[model samples]
Target chain A: MSVNILLFKITLLFYSVATVLYLVDVVRRKEKAGKTGKAARWILVGGFALHCATLLARYLEAGYTPVANLHESLSFFAWTLVGIFLLFDIRYRMTVLGAFSCPLAVILMLIGSTAPTAMKELNPALDSWWFPVHVTLAFLGNAVFTVAFVAGVMYLLQERMLKSKKFSALYYRLPSLDVLDSINYKCLSFGFPLMTMGIISGAVWANSAWGGYWRWDPKETWALITWFLYAALLHGRLTVGWRGRRAAIFAIIGFLCLLFTFLGVNLLLSDLHSFKAMEGP
Target chain B: MMNIIVVGLSHKTAPVEIRERVAFAPTDMGRPLHEMRALPAVAEGIIVSTCNRVELYAGTHAPEACVGQLKAFLAAYHGIPAEQLEEHLYDYQGEEAIRHVFRVSSSLDSMVIGEPQILGQIKTAYGYAAEHKTVGSVLNRFLHKAFSVAKRVRTETDIASNAVSVSFAAVELARKIFGSLDGKKVMLIGAGEMCELAARHFLNNGAASVMVTNRTLERAVKLAEEFQGQAVPFEEFPQRLHQVDIVLTSTGAPNFILGQEKMEEVIRQRKNKPMFLIDIAVPRDIDPKVNKIDNIYLYDVDDLQGVVQANLKERQKEAKKAEVIIDQEIGQFSRWLENRDVVPTIVALRKKFEEIRQGELRKTFSNLKDLGPKERQAIEALTAAIVNKMLHPPTSVLKQNQETASGSDYVDAVRTLFDLEIAQEEDDSELS
Candidate 1:
């Protein structure tokens, strides 16, 4: 196997270990939990560094950005998600977040491993400066939304536990609703603008290459739908003071739409953005 | 083994009259601490005296004698008869004593569970003992471990995270709403003792300013002067309502003083800033409907009591978790104490055998003028093996039984049967 493939395998191993450690932290609930969480964070950092190295190596071999195919895109997506999660973990000091986020990242990386790893040349139509900017912004926005989705799920669980007045491990482990709501708001404020910029850049790139900006392609249509859903969420929150459980539910819905746009549109439907060369034998 | 022993009378075992009589004055603690250390069996001593409890923690080789002397000392020092003091006093030895100190430092033994003052009180008492040069290595290590256990319990549980009093509950609710009380203004409408107490709670939590108003201007001025706040006219208080973040109304007015419509305008004037209104009067000063307004949260006396009750129940639950932590730490400390007990005995036994073997070897060597170096070495090895063979069974028994309650009995029997002179100074040196 190539060095990049070996590095990718190592990254997968680190993420798997981190996921187990985070789960152990959830179950142990004391000094052991704190120690395991710190260990998991360090391992995740190591994995992230190796993931970056693998991407760079692949970039060197491909003579372009490595995210032109399904495998590379999925790997990039997981890397950005873990990066966003680390930032949240540092700021909030909520180690329990790893219990949810690490597993999600591991699943994404596992799926990436299944896809073909062979580097393919970019389509001539896709050769533009705006491509990398659009892809990075889109993935970064998805990563932020991923954090919001996790926080939303935790909020719902905490709210249920609180309303029922049954104090369990979940109740003690999850952060308060006020904290989760603020995090949800922050993620939305950050992710919405990046998503808008990603869509705008994609539109501009399409106009330059395909001579049309508003094609009703399945991917573009779904991206627009996801953007509108988040737009409504932000509008309701800022104007009408929509928050708490209602806001949490909307965040979950918005993430589902985002997931369908990113994954379902690329795989289940034919589109101009599809990388046909990714399905290598 | 130097066992830890605690003798004390707390609020649970003694009334305030008896507790106050037994409590040592802070200035006079040095005399009793020194006297305690001078006792026959007490290797280390610390006296903790607070309004709620008076406790003595000591390290002693003979726990029974130490406890007896401490009881006599308490009665003699306080000028009370020993018979009168015995009914109110309680004592714990060994692992129980360790657990008691751990629970006390964690605030689990407080009159109001999770109250924070007992830890500071215990620390001050320990400080007095440490300064007087009365406490030694055992007590120093024990107290430090208790402190760490207390810290661990605090971080690992939510024992102290709730309010047990009405005023404290109001402050806790305000914190939940506003995050912090810093720079927030409080307005008191009319004068009631409970309302003033809650206002003081907010002030203590860092509210910036206070405004007092009553039906009579002079009364308002009097109350304002007492609180170091400005006096506002009762009629004009509603106009200035937007300036304050918290409103505490306790007027005896039979009707509601603040209504929903007025509060809506007040909230709007404050630009939707959050407001906490606490109505503490029996007839209820603020209208309950006002609570429905945006950014306005109102709680009456019953609601505050409800919060206090809920918080108290939560503290009780967290206290159970703290107990589990204390149990684990007690197991660890007891094991350490057991090892400390056994090591010196083992050393003394070995030293006694080696001394006899050396004396006999020297006598035989003096008589054998033809002794070769090889022959001398062979004799030394043979004597050492015989000593080892003879000592192994008792040594193993002592090591194996160190953790049991009968371990000390076995140690004493061995010492008496062998006529071992385990010099106290020599044992201390061996331990060091």
Candidate 2:
């Protein structure tokens, strides 16, 4: 009912339209599909800019960073994903990633709106600046990993077609396996450090707030699992020379773990981070 | 008259075992072509040798005689019974054969339709034959046309889409794991071919550094130099595995090299950061139990195969769409070939009728000497119309026959019966 909520809803609508255009482009393989892809990207960017305005307006209206509750966290996470995608576009000029990343952003935004929006008491730990820092870094890491996941999926699909010797229009439309793999690796390289810093910051925050730095909480465990998966990917590249599809699979699994950590831990189980699930399904 | 016929087993009709038996490795292609050309009726020849196929493109003056000679040549070359291979041999003559070569060079006839490798293979074979002086005017024209068709196919269709091979698949999986690999350290624990492929994928993906450890330091060093990675002692592999985020092992080891206990220690040293392990070796090098470690993610051969199989299925689906494009190209090429045979006969027939009309015009002018020049011109035009009307039916028939399989033969028959050859000879003599 609020202006911010309305704008957020509008962003989702635009994103949905973008997803359709991309899918049509991929299937029909028409030259006009490229034009559609460009239009979708521009619309997504417009929606993202509007979404940023909504977040800022909400911050002014609510008297706090909008990353406090489950809905707010999801919104912030989606915002970071678009931010990362824009950054990728600047460097790689990969328009197709908008097709995958935009839909993901839309899904997250939709899920975000459904979460309970009632103002709740902020715990002492939440009052600290470190809370925002940790959450923001972790989300950014996840956002970067999400892009990597998309690239990895494309890479696998492309590689398979190549191996099977099946050359088609879709195959040509998709980025080369080499390009996707490199992009995935680049995303992970950037993501892994952010995630590591987030985890470390979270650990320090936990130690300051609760007198324990490391706990075997479900969220923490899953985050560790995801981090380990990425770590293995990094190590495999250095020591074992694991580079292409093998590396891509690991990156995908890592992002999946990250998704589990972000959403699954909050929805499926109870832990120290249970309070964070105020908006989760 | 000559015909170029290509009939043999390829990767499509024959398995590797069968294809290899008949495959003339690049080195053997020259001698085989020379030997096949020495047979009766053979005029010129070229051999296409690739991992998936072995086809002999032969232009012979006597096609029927050369078919037997080609069969015998294959039988003797591979020691396979001629009858056993006869079922796979498909023969095409003249224009049909030319179309076949163009389709093949363009990858329209490939097992994995639209693959680009066949074009290069065709080019290489053609180049070799040219060097040997084995392919002359007719074959030269055909081969050049084939190259042009290949270029056209690539330009016209979206056949070169997001294709990836097994080597790159490993790199893609890595990217999925780490998100970005710009400054990531990778450990390659073997110097096997699969490892080299994976390493190349990594280098392509922006992995900043790579280290290879192998028992045979020579092979390790060799592969390392090629991939811009370092080679370390095999025994120290576990020590480096902890520092790096990814491990790809494809060694020729007999036993497991990386155990769970070893990985657990490595994880501790990594401060519980994630680690990805890929063992592409047979008699697997990395222990499967390592997958149970808190921060270790291990993938064996079967796991990679699962990804490979899934990717292959997706490609197969795309291939179906590509086939439609190839079929359309084939139809267009056939139509063009059909149209080419009709133009010459149509030109000759028009000239013959014009000669008759001109001869009648001269006779009429001689008999009516008092008529004005304008009247004479008018009379000549009227006579020309009559000749054109009389010739219309046969010309239409000739045009219709041009599209049929017997079109060329019909044109030849018409030319001989009308004494068009003699007329052409006399015209040439007059011009000279």
Candidate 3:
């Protein structure tokens, strides 16, 4: 009903339309160049711009970072996901990647829209420069993992089809195991540092505000768990040469842990990071 | 009409032994061209000789006699019995001949339909004929049209874009896995011909290097020298497998040469870099379970065959589109051929009338020597106009019928009635 919500809906529209265009290209392309892929990418760029405006508008109006509640967090998460996907798309030119990622972005935006979009008052203890820095880094890491998760699923699908000789349209549409594995490796190498920095920044902020760095909060513990899962996967890949199906399966598990840490911990547990739970519901 | 005739034995009609015997050497096509030109019915001739087909495209006056004579000449020139070659040779005349050449040039008639080599082979055949002064106006025009039609089919359809052979299909799969074949290493496990062929395909697709390993070290060295690669001793190939990205095995062994346990160790040694293994042997060299190993993909000959078959089906769909283009182009070329026949008759008819007119004018001019230069120019213009007017009806009729089914009949009547065939004969003789 409000202007920022209006902007959010328009952003959602752009992403949904982009999703459809990407899917159409995915279904139609047989290793041939098509206009739909390029069009979808441009439209996603428009959506990303509008999503940024929506976040900025909320920031200016509410006088704090926009990602303080469930609705804002999901919207910001989808926004960052699209930003990372576009970066990878520019590098890879994998139309199927857009076809997979844009739909996920659209679905997240839709679910976020279902939650209340009221501009809630920020908790006084949480209103600090560390809030934006910590959230942005964490969101960026999760966004990179999101793309890696997509690539991992594609790897498993392609490997199964090639091994069982039961090929589908997806088998032809997906990239090779080598390409998918490399993408996963790139994401982990890059995402790991951002996530580590996010956790450390959160610790610094927590120590300054709450008189402790490592509080045994549910969100903190879950974030640490997610970090360890990805850490083990990374260590295995580097030292033991773990790759392909085994690596893809672990990346998927690591991504699931990340999703829970982002959403499940905040919604289900009474923690200092639970913004919605602070409103007594 | 100009009778385009094709007399040939292709892979469809003849065995390799018979075809190879009848094939003409491309390096020395001069003698054959001279011999074919001397044939009673063949006006112009071009011979296309490839490993798959040996065909003679000839412009002829008598299609029936030309077909038999070309067949006989093929057998006699090759020192084979006429009866033996007769059963293998096939002939086409008029529209059928044009369609046959078009299909051959488009690669639709190839043993592997849609393969690109046939078009280049046809161009080389045309080049030889052009150099020898064998193919004249009709064949030169027709072959050019054939080339353009082939180009049309290539651009309008996707027939030649997909891999429909085993070796090509393997390369296609490798491309999908590696995204690009640059700097990748290929290994051939044995000295089988198919294995060598697959290795060549990989090299052509930009595999950085090749390693050859055979049961016999001498043979390995010989094969490796030909490919300009290293010959790994058979005993050391297992240890060297880690260096290769693609492995092609076609040994005549009874048991598996590459077991799952060995492949696992090899993948580890390669530092989880993916390996594409192709077992070209009937008794599979690599164990099937190796396919289940991470970063290791194994395909036997049957799997490659499956890919080839699927790609063949896709090409067939594209080939149908090519056929449509061929059919549309045939109409334009057929009209051109018909117009060619009518054009000679019309030219000879006009030339006969001009000769008569000039003879009469010269006599008139001598008698009227006092006539001015202006009057002489006026008289010449008058004669041209009258001749054109007198010739208009029959000329229009010939032009109209040139595109019809009865076009040849009208041309023959005009040529015979005016004795234009004699004039055309002289014209052709003077040109030759």
Task: Please name the candidate that would achieve the greatest TM-score relative to the true structure.
Answer: 3
Better of 2 and 3 by TM-score: 3
Q: What is the per-residue lDDT of model 1 for residues A1-281, given as tens digits with 9 covering 90 to 100?
A: 98888998999999999999988888652322478888989999899999999888888877777787788888999999999999998898777888889899999999999998887667777678888888999999999999999989987886664433334555556765667888899999999999999999989988987899979998889999989989998998887667766778988999999999988888999788777833333
- Candidate by candidate, in order, the iRMS in Å equals 5.3, 11.1, 1.7
Per-residue C-alpha lDDT of model 2 across residues B1-96, encoded as one tens digit per residue: 445687666767778877778888776567887887677667678888788777888866567877788878987987999888777666677666
Residue B322 lDDT in candidate 2: 48
By lDDT: ranked, best first: 3, 1, 2
lDDT per residue for candidate 3 within A1-281, as digits (tens), equals: 77789999999999999999999988752665378888988999999999999999988988888888789999999999999998998898898999889898998899999998787777676677888999999999999999989999888888887777656656666777678989999999999999999999989988876889997888899999989989998999999888888888888998999998988888777778887533322
lDDT of 2: 0.74
lDDT, candidate 2, residue A127? 62
Worst 10 residues of 1 chain B by lDDT: B422-431
Candidate 2 falls in which docking quality class? incorrect
Candidate 1 has a DockQ of 0.18
Model 3 quality (TM-score): 0.78
